[model samples]
Target: MHDTSLYSSILGLSSQWHIANAVLDSKARSLRLDIAARSCAEFCCPVCGGAAVRVGADKGCWQHEDLLNMRFHISAVIPVTLCKTCGTNRISVPWERAGSCFRCMDNP
Candidate 1:
């Protein structure tokens, strides 16, 4: 079993989300963390305060700080929601900005 807490802390992730899996390749010297949402029912529209429905996911990876001297990538199937008022919108992530390739969890 892998240490979820370690990755969680490394990524500064909330308990609401957890690392679904992590792939480590010695030859490639890379670590990829697959993140999954704990619950979609609690998600709300960014523009409106109304409940949203999951339409699909946007699969992408964000470059992360080096871990154990290996290049790290934090990947996720970020939920795309259909808001009653906004039509369709991407869910805001906690680790990165609304639209960015870099993780801004520790950044001000």
Candidate 2:
């Protein structure tokens, strides 16, 4: 597949999965990266659909490949929210699934 096709597929998959903005930046040391963020309001308890309050943040990073054989790093600030009604903590991510390595999945 062509580079554009590959990128398009990844973007499509991400959007289908409700993934947030997938930024492509070269300024940082990493060649390519996908960043995701979530807020307290986004958190929804698995047991209930109630909104959860911000409890804390979890910092994480993931590596992926770009269109031109460039390496991309995905950094995320995951939010942990506490549901008052359920008394449970909810984890929310602004991007798609964590383990999805688009670069690896898309072969040209």
All candidates' lDDT scores?
0.73, 0.49
| Range of the 10 consecutive residues with the lowest summed lDDT in candidate 2 | 13-22
Q: What is the TM-score of each candidate against the true structure?
A: 0.70, 0.47
lDDT of 2 by residue, 1-108 (tens): 113335445544333122344454456534443334323245566457787666776666655654355666545555666787877553643334565554332223
- State the lDDT of candidate 1 residue by residue for 1-108, as single tens digits: 467787787667776577889878889898878898776445678678688888877776677556678878877877788997899987877767544445533333
Instruction: Give the Å shift of residue 58 in candidate 2.
Output: 0.8
Model 1: worst 10 consecutive residues (lDDT sum): 99-108
Residue runs of model 1 more than 4 Å from their true location after superposition: 25-29, 39-41, 65-69, 98-108
User: For all the candidates, what are their Cα RMSDs to the real structure?
Assistant: 5.0, 8.1
Error of 1 at 100 (Å): 8.7
